[model samples]
Target chain A: MKEFKYVITDNEGIHARPAGELVKLAKTFASEVKVAKDGKEADCKKIFALMGLGVKKDQEVCFKVTGEDEDAACEALEQFMRENL
Target chain B: MKTYSGKSVYGGIAIGRIHVYKKNESMVRREKIDNPDAEMERYERAKAEAVAQLKGLYDKALKEVGEVNAAIFEIHQMMLEDDDYNESVENIVRTQHVNAEYAVASTGDNFAKIFAEMEDEYMRERAADVKDISERLLAVLGGGSAGAVQSQEPVIIAADDLAPSETVQLDKDKVLAFVTVHGSTNSHTAILAKTMGIPALIGTDVELEEIDGKFGIVDGLEGKFYVEPDEELLAQMREKQQAELAQKEMLQSLKGKENVTLDGRKVMLYANIGNVKDLPKVMQNDAGGIGLFRSEFLYLESDHFPTEEEQFQVYKTVAETMAGKRAIIRTLDIGADKKCDYFGLEAEENPALGYRGIRICLTRTDVFKTQLRALFRASAFGKLAIMYPMIISVDEIRRIQEIVAEVKAELTENGTPFGEPEQGIMIETPAAVMVSGELAKEVDFFSIGTNDLTQYTLAIDRQNPRLDEFYDPHHPAVLRMIAMVVENAHRENTWVGICGELGADTELTEEFLKMGVDELSVSPNYILPVRKRIRETNLEA
Candidate 1:
């Protein structure tokens, strides 16, 4: 299992569009990814779960990945946020 | 046999059986069920069928309008899958032994009723969505096709509210006018009707079923509907219709010509665009230039504020398309009413009076800076001018200039190439108008945001139902303010433009030209008419 922390850079924070984008990215990997912000954790594959976290701009969130592709998942998710979010 | 009068918001005369879109009642009948397991199975089957039916409707919509509009159905799909919608139907079907169709219909109707009863206009409009979904589901259950419009002749559409998709299906030549029991001027249906040149009267208390197949006249401009019109009234309406058609033909003839007055005083007719999606319409209208390019659409429907590159792509497209014609881009003017959860702006009690326009931009420098950088970058591609909205003071204008200077300095230091774009301020507030002489001296140009200006001058809360009656752009005070800004800007040799609904007012086009307003910026559809109006007027003293 690997855990990494990043701040949301998207202007709308982790709202519907970004959450959907994140979920789509998470589903591409075999690893189970969970995102948590301020003690609220959500399955990275579900848009509603990510939205429920109510992450705002610049707010920090942690991502934990578990599975054979855990390192790859964390690396890819981090890079995705850096590039797009 | 009842008649209620309202301002005719769109124009046409029609005689048709009013098809009262009543809440489907049969869906509410409860059935007595004996076996829980069988009931549950039946409920699931009904939901599946309804969902499948909804999917088909969505696919049809996709084929008709494109994916963005079809995406509106995604909300209905969500509602179908919602715990409240699905679970409610499931519980009723299981407990009452009702068929899945009946259960879903009943639950949908109940929800629609609740929404219809809501006091908030936005919430009340949700009832239409409920009705839309329910109607789609019922059609599926009945084995009827989607995209069905009544095949009757010369009908007037009366509904609680008409969705944009539904309104698009209406054949303008066949349908007379639209009368809605509830709708706002800003509703998608109204906006679309305006673009399509259809007459619509919204917010009427008249029940549609009572007037079905009745001869009626709808005056969209006056927001009035007349049922079973007398001979004299019908004759007068016919004459008026002929005059309007003649006027429209005259306007159509003015297309592809520059708007020069009778005495040869030229006035630029431009379009106020919200997004690149509207570019095609702008081009079709042969607009002189883009008067107001609302940049807020970039932030809307996105996860984050658009990056400089993303912003560049949009700005570049609009600027390049115009090909040296001016494109006045307004910075993000979002506030309480047009809130973005991404900005983390706290909900203000009075959003209009609260932190909005230049206020939000001033406070959130990071957000403002990003937009400035993008605008500066896009300036290289075309004739671009950055216009700030809701400027109430000279200090605000100075602060913005300071930031622009700072951004320019940074860009220079970083070796980023950019063209200098003219800076302008939207003189919307009473304070802005009051200080126009001082503001005119600082800015390259000025555009009157008359919508906000009128609202502020009359001390009327435009969103307040009680104050709507007082929200008039033609009020003497509002006109004087516009005249004031135009005079002030002209004195400084800076051009002034009017970029509000008033700009498109056919009657006021000559008045605006006389007031020394350099340009009138309106919606794309109004370009030809406004140009024609301008061409007919003698502006030169």
Candidate 2:
């Protein structure tokens, strides 16, 4: 398993559009990706889960990946934060 | 010849054969299929074709409008792929031995009926989406063309109501006017029409089929549409259209010029914006700043209260758009009138008179503080001013100021990057007007919210149909209160702006200029005309 903590940078937080993008990205990897904030976890693949997280800009959260491609998932998610977050 | 009258939300005349677009009703037809294997194959083919057609529609929408708006089609795409819809259609095709078209149509009709019965207006509207998807599926199964309306040069597009996506597909050059049976000022279609500068008449009960292709003149500014205009009236309308065009050209010429009076006094002309979507329009008008950025839109649409960082991003976008220009953000002013079920604010017997605006903010310090902190953080990007709405007394002003100071101190302690934005009060309440001098001394500036000022000063419920006649902003008492507030703010050497509908009133522009209002924040459509009015006036006298 691999994990990384990061802050939400998008102005709208994890709104429907950004959440959809995140879900699409998660589906591409073999790892089971999940996001947690304020001690609550949400499946990274479900758009509703990300939206329900109510993550706002500058709010910090952690992403965890566990599976065959955990390393790849972590690397891709980190790059996503660096570019589009 | 028949005639009917209704509120003309947009203005223009049309002459043509009435092209009545009847609302599509779901149709259910059944046929016997001899082979279950062949029926299953038909269902699979139908689903594939429906998905492809949906993608095609989405592609067209994306190309014409943009991704953000095109995203609405994703819902329809999801409905097409829903397992329940697929299973229901397959069951009908296999058990009843029906053709693919008939099976798909039956399933769609049932689902659409269910959705139409939903209480939520947003969900009810999804019935149309279901019908649209089903129509595409049936069309594919029947080997017919996809049921997409081609962009045509229609002189006047008449309908019961137009979806935002459909409005976007309209050809601006050919579409001289639009007539609809229902729509409101806030509808996305209306907003789009306004942006496109097209003449439209909405909420008219006139049978659209009767006047679809008729020559008439529409006066959007006056909310009047003349069908089959007489020659004399057509001539007059032609002249008016020419004058309006010339005025638009003149305003375009004055785009980069500062809004200065004939006597050389400068008055800032700013845009009143509701969301970041309006930022482009504000910039297009060459507005000096955002006079009133209603932050309620950010909170109203969200399922929960927006976090400080989320608020900061929206505020930052506005600040960056304005660059060095000021963006005055009013905190969430939701109350009985603009109710949010999430906030648990009950409907009041008298909403306008009840707990709202600054009162809500005062009682809900956590909400107010989060917004204040975000505003401070965004201030680093550009000029930002925080304005409190519905401020009724000096006490409220002092209290909010204290809270702002506390937030600033906390941010400093946490080493969060932020700067203190200039704080101000909206002179809306009668009490606020009476205490303007004192409040002005405490705050950086004053903005007269004439809508609420008129409502409270006259003790009339503006939203009540019975009291609408008495809710006039032109009432002498309302004018007197505004004058008092403006005078007091000036006496304190603090800038005062008029940001309500009164700012856009051409009849009162000279009077406001005479009263020495430092700024006029209005809708983008009125900016040029107001600027022209100021230029023609002798303010020094």
Candidate 3:
């Protein structure tokens, strides 16, 4: 499993636009991706599940990936979080 | 006559018969289905229809509103395609043996509840999106037409609150105006009204039953809705509407005409804009140039200080849009009544006389440098000018020049191409006017901000309603300062312009021309009227 953590910097925590974008990015990878905050896990590919996490500003969340494309998914998601979330 | 007041989205007069819009009735009742397979198939078909409808609305919104507002439709399409939501409907239809409409409605309720219960306020608002998309599906399943306006003639649309999709479905030609009991200035209805160039009122507390089909007038300027107005009121409003239309036609004739006096003395008539959204109005009014582009919106709108690239893109857009017409952008004028939380500005007893404008910029060199870098880089795109506000001394100008020199030197080191934009300062202070000769020699031009000049000279707080009677712009003291500044700027071979509320005061147009004010920059709406006034005046007379 490939895992990494990121803190959301956007004033609006995991807003519809960026959350939708994150789901699109996650769907591109064959890896089974999940986002977890405070021990609760959500499927990264699902917009509603990811948004349900309610990861607010300055709150750290962990993304875990398992599959052939796990390395690429981790890199891409980390980059996306920094740029958008 | 009964009158109701609401917030005006666009200013003008709209008088027409009222047409209270009502949403489609979609009361889904659970029906027993013998074949669950057929019901699932029906649910799938309705979902497809809903998606197609959303796509069509997306395209329509894209054309009517810009991409930002149109994006909501695209998001709705994605939400419709959500696997969990569709599975829930399919499960309910297959297991419970219910009709497609009931299954879809129940699924919508469950998902909307999930979003509504979310901890984040923004996510909670997404509940409405869920409801909106589900409602679309329900409408398709029930074989009912979505929010339709049934009217033979153009009539004012009064509603409780219109969804984005409903607002887009409205026939522009058949809709005279919009008045809603619940909505905000940023609502889709308001934005659509603005794009359509029709007067709209929001939050008007009026019963639809009483006003439907009634002859009513929407005075957007006064934010008043008059139902069954008396003959005297109707006559007054009709005359006012006629005069407004006549004035608009007359102003349209002034387009492409020079801002010149009968005696052949010419002056530059420009527009003051807050952002690029006002660019259309600026062009429509035939402004010679953009005299004052307030840059405060960049900082005020953002949660953090806008990065250099962000500021650069905005400035570049204004430059490119103006197409060589002079665009004078004032550097960040924060503090005072406009406060940004990220700036960490302390609450002052008197913010007006406290840390604000150029004072904040001079103190915070890092923030100032980032903005200067962006402004200088954007200058290469068009005839851009930079102006500093809240100046009272020659030393401050010199300090700013040194910083500009440093910025230009750094840009050269980095090999970034930037044009040398004309630098100017606002002469809004009495002290600046007193020492105008020295100040004029330091800058390329002078733009007198008469509103601040009047307030400062009269020692009256412009924001204080109690001082409205005492606050006077026509004080001889203020005029004398302007005249002195003009004379000094002329001696230094520097051009001068008036860019404030007083510039648009038609009564003072000739007086300003007589004082040799080379330019007048007012709001876009007043450009043509001021131009007409300037054309009629014979300075020699």
Give me the candidate number with maximum lDDT: 3
Judged by DockQ cut-offs, is candidate 3 incorrect, acceptable, medium or high?
acceptable
Residues B1-541, model 2: lDDT tens digits: 3444556554444443334444333444566768978878876877777677557656765544334445556645656765567788888877787877787777877877765775545445556656667776766666655423444645566678776645655555556677778876656567666555577878876666567556655566666666776777778777878877677778878777878878888889999989888865776577888899999988888988887767877787677657678889998888887877788998798777788988888898998899898889888878999998888788888898798889999988976678668888888889888888888898888999888888777887666799875566699888888888889898888889999999999889888878888899999878988888888888667
Cα RMSD, each candidate: 11.8, 10.6, 7.3
* Model 2 ranges with Cα > 4 A deviation: A1-4, A7-85, B1-244, B468-472
- Per-model DockQ: 0.15, 0.11, 0.37
Please write out the lDDT profile of model 1 over residues B334-370, one tens digit for every residue: 9888978898889888888999988889999998999
Docking class of 2: incorrect
Off by over 4 Å in 1: A1-85, B1-3, B7-19, B22-71, B77-98, B106-131, B163-165, B170-173, B249-291, B294-327, B330-526, B529-541
Top candidate (DockQ): 3
DockQ, computed on Cα atoms, for candidate 1: 0.15
Provide a comma-separated list of chain B TM-scores, one per candidate.
Answer: 0.56, 0.58, 0.62
Better of 2 and 3 by TM-score: 3
What TM-score would chain A of each candidate receive against the reference chain A?
0.92, 0.94, 0.97
